[model samples]
Target: MATAGLITWPVTLTIGAGHLLAHNKHMRLLRSFGEALEEA
Candidate 1:
């Protein structure tokens, strides 16, 4: 529904922002982990 979407859109953006912040904070570690998984 349009109403539901309006309510969730900002919530989704907030969560996405938080995820980006965390990802940046651990980017190097995450990259190495991904590489290890690929090699497995």
Candidate 2:
């Protein structure tokens, strides 16, 4: 199990990082959209 855990840990971290990056991108897009609406 130790070996399995060691292998899976990086995969888990990669998935978590991907999720965080996607969330940040989405938030930025929403912020830009809100700003455009305020300008209009």
Candidate 3:
């Protein structure tokens, strides 16, 4: 069980990082799109 936890910890961190990055990218895109709409 300790070995399984050690292996999963890095996997969990990697997944969390990926989710955060994707969310940030999505928010950036939405902000840019809103700006474009305002300009138009």
Candidate 4:
């Protein structure tokens, strides 16, 4: 139904944003670790 789709669209976007934030955090950690390794 149209109503259902409207409800789900925001939920889907919220979930996508969460995933992107998590991925960015993970990548940042990995990058910092790589820098440490390079320094050592």
Error of 1 at 26 (Å): 0.4
Per-residue lDDT of 20 in model 1: 96
Off by over 4 Å in 4: 1-7
Q: lDDT at 38 for candidate 2?
A: 100
For model 1, what is the error of residue 7's alpha carbon versus the real structure, in angstroms, after optimal superposition?
6.3
Q: Write the per-residue lDDT of candidate 4 for residues 1-40, one digit (tens) a residue.
A: 3356755767788888999999999999999999999999
TM-scores, all models, native as reference: 0.50, 0.82, 0.81, 0.82
| Candidate 2 deviation (Cα RMSD) | 3.7
Q: Give the lowest summed-lDDT range of ten residues in model 3.
A: 1-10
Error of 4 at 35 (Å): 0.1
Lowest lDDT block of 10, candidate 1: 1-10
The residue-level lDDT of candidate 2 at 21 comes to 100
Report the Cα lDDT for candidate 3: 0.87
- Model 2 clash pairs are none
Candidate 3 vs. true structure, TM-score? 0.81
Candidate 2, 1-40: lDDT as tens digits = 3356755867788888999999999999999999999999
Winner by TM-score between candidate 3 and candidate 1: 3
Candidate 1 clashes: the total is 0
RMSD of 4: 3.7
Q: State in Å the error of residue 21, model 4.
A: 0.2
